[model samples]
Target: MGGYVRATPMAVQADEGVPPSTSLPDIGAASFGAGDVTVETVHLPDDRVQITNTAAYPWRVHCSLHVTAADNSEWIGTGWFIGPHTLITAGHVVCIKHSGVPGRDGWVRSIRVMPGRNGATLPYGSVTSTNFWSVKGWFESGDQNYDYGAIIIPTELGSNTGWFGFGNWSDAELLSTVGNISGYPGDKPAGTQWYAARGISSVNALKVHYDIDTAGGQSGSAVYRVLNGNRYGFAVHAYGGATTNSGTRITRQVYDNFVAWKA
Candidate 1:
């Protein structure tokens, strides 16, 4: 399956509702650093830069979600800080499968956000969340396009560590520019972060496809680009494959939900 693995038994339910659309100002440049890149490649490594200490990529987060069912098992995913208290992730990360229905059960019991998580060490401690948000389309029908979601913590972690701005870019721009993804992969020791870089392989209306090497725990990781010294996440990674991985593209709906959650 392209989706994440459950640590224990779980159930699915409908999401409360989609975030109501609102009028929020764009946090970063509308089209900053797009069309400035020309080179493209398939799969690339992070050039051995230590992501935990890199100043340019400060908002990467390690997420641990506790399923609130009988088994009380825990599953891991990756997320990124988009606001002082808001972190973005994949909806499936916070949702459970329906018993006999087609969609999700509801939000996970709780989530822990650890920004700048190194191996076996939490550089910024961790914040737990009871508040979670995802589009109704995802929970209602498991639409891959709307599989993105958010976490609202109680503290201002982004203030100290900074957060990634988000944007929507054209397929031409995304394919030409270099993209970066760093997250906790299940194949490694739990909570250990890994990094990868590559030009996007393809782009569809709802997903950004890339050759980045990602494992189960990396679902919900940020698929971002550093443009003009600013890192803007454009997708929430969810599906993994042997040759290609994909993320829910930050479409207008996804972008608006993110803004509403931040508000």
Candidate 2:
């Protein structure tokens, strides 16, 4: 697969790049049910109370992306900080996908990232992107396997909430580990955030499947694992399947690109 990059509206001057750090707070290992366990799912009845607080997930950011080709269309998705200025998301959230054809002429006009956005609340303020990026396989062929993207912001948002670490893990680690997903769902009030935690049900080279209840705007949500007191995002949530929702798995290339972007 090939790679591609897109430009967004210019960002206001902000801090210089924050060097990547290895100092992550150890959140400890997540627990799961024993013996042939079946995961139970719960949708947040009140997004404000459940996920609005910065303490809940300081790294979670709500994205407002504008596409010009779709009649100045505005879409809501989710993303998280991987570095002081780099945010990761799904490529479809940034590019326009055409059915049965290569991607049409849709490009991101602008993008706003609100860190820890609760209903009508912006705890850390909002930042706009200076640039956008994605794999060529998705923009060129609408390949779901490469449905991931990143946004470059001006501020050091990670300094306030910290950021998620990225790694390539085996299917065994995914299936056995408890995962958490948090994002803004379109079904809920605008800017509202919700979350769900469940054990991964399946995994592949390109995706990780879970029973996590997510809605339309939740695409680009972070599918992360809490380990040794630290959280690392393993996938970028994209497709919501019938019985499961899947995210683009973090492969070696994905990890390398992310690291390079941070630098």
Candidate 3:
């Protein structure tokens, strides 16, 4: 018999550097899942160290964020892949809050995700997406405690690059663990990635506070801990406070949501 080939459905990906639409036809605030500044909440003597070699594992997993809000206002934040095509960030990153104008207060217009991006250099390239998701607590009320969300890209960009495993940890476990945060900070050069690690300062039902240095654009960065050589996320970085920055803890409910969204 002559050689034959069976066609298999393959994931179609845009060419490297194919940027997302600069302006999505106004979707209006109602038709969205929605909704920063480029201010990191870093403490005095910023301890964040830049990751110049963004092509490596873990570091490469970090992404620089550029969001176009529903009101067409632009901001910067950070996000990380947790699944083949899913990236998690602050709920505010997906849905703008207050914005002073209620009419422009829902989901963001679009986002351009650059994984493992180095300053002026895209080691892993970039993709623009309009798909986003957030919980009712945030989507409806814009609660800071509920400020965490996911961005789904059409391509499986994480397959080759890999992702982080997120889980719910007890207060005891979290308090005893040192959390890690790495992302693009506004205080640093545009597109460059930075990192910090510190013992978790506090943990509550809704938030995990840490002394890890982070600036404005670092929101949505994973607050993860390494266990036996594996990295597992315990929270979703969200707010910066005067004493300590914090994240939305990955409670059972949030973990369930993440699993559901990834599926």
Candidate 4:
């Protein structure tokens, strides 16, 4: 609870200081229900973002992204289209302090949505969120599982152009089944372009943990799966209290609120 703060929007100054780097021990992989998810391995340099995928079955979906404060700043994140122009991501990614100010000119630099792996440059379209929200409990409790946020994408994504719809929230019974997940880990310098992990839990809770690997830059990555023969995004990366090498659970929370916003 040392680094805990309310998940509320506050003005921020440009971050002129170099981003600090911390290395945590890698945990081991986890096993799950059969044939539901398949992970694709990806490697990265010692100093890049890390990520893993698990949604085994393929249902076509696109990723949502935003620009970094510094040009070429290696800030990367993961997101999926929920509606025509609306994409969902961890609010922290799209919203950052400009410098170190508490409530100043913090703004989203840029945002983009890509259709497949290896398409970071080609933003299906970019937009900003008019409003953002997070659970008060998540902020006060310091539980990574409850961390959530949404973006109110621009006109371009809403008009049958670049957006994708969301999937219904499956019960704990459904999440206990198998599923695959994907995301772009900005920390990874190479290996596979998109970090993919397989066989993750689909349960709904404040802390639905998984064995999928990820790192700091992957904070906003998506956790999804193929249910009922359709691919749908259901969650986003909040934080990791454990590691893949240590058999740690990649903590996440379902995007129920965002889905409700779309409906």
Tens-place lDDT digits, model 3, residues 98-183:
66665667677777789998876777788777778888788777667787888888788888678999999899999999999998
Runs in model 2 lying further than 4 Å from the true structure: 2-4, 8-49, 55-70, 99-104
Which digits, one per residue and each the tens of the lDDT, describe model 4 over residues 94-201?
A: 444222333422334443344333332222323434344444434344233344555544354444333433444436544465444555554454212344554554
Of models 1 and 4, which has the larger TM-score? 1
TM-score of each: 0.75, 0.79, 0.85, 0.56
**Candidate 1 residue-wise lDDT, 122-235, digit = tens:** 656666666667767665666656677787777787777778889988889888987778876655555556678778989998889888766556667789898988889998
A best-first ranking of the candidates according to their lDDT comes to 3, 2, 1, 4
lDDT for 174 in candidate 4 is 41
Q: Model 4 residue 157 lDDT? A: 45
> Of the pair 2 and 4, which is ahead by TM-score?
2
The total number of steric clashes, by the backbone 3 Å criterion, in model 3 comes to: 10
- For candidate 2, what is the TM-score? 0.79
In TM-score terms, candidate 1 sits at: 0.75
| Winner on TM-score (1 vs 2) | 2
Off-target runs (Cα >4 Å) in candidate 1 are 1-71, 98-104
Q: In model 2, state the lDDT of residue 13.
A: 40
Q: Is candidate 1 or candidate 2 better by lDDT?
A: 2
Error in Å for residue 195 of model 4 = 4.3
How much is 111 displaced in model 2, in angstroms?
A: 0.6
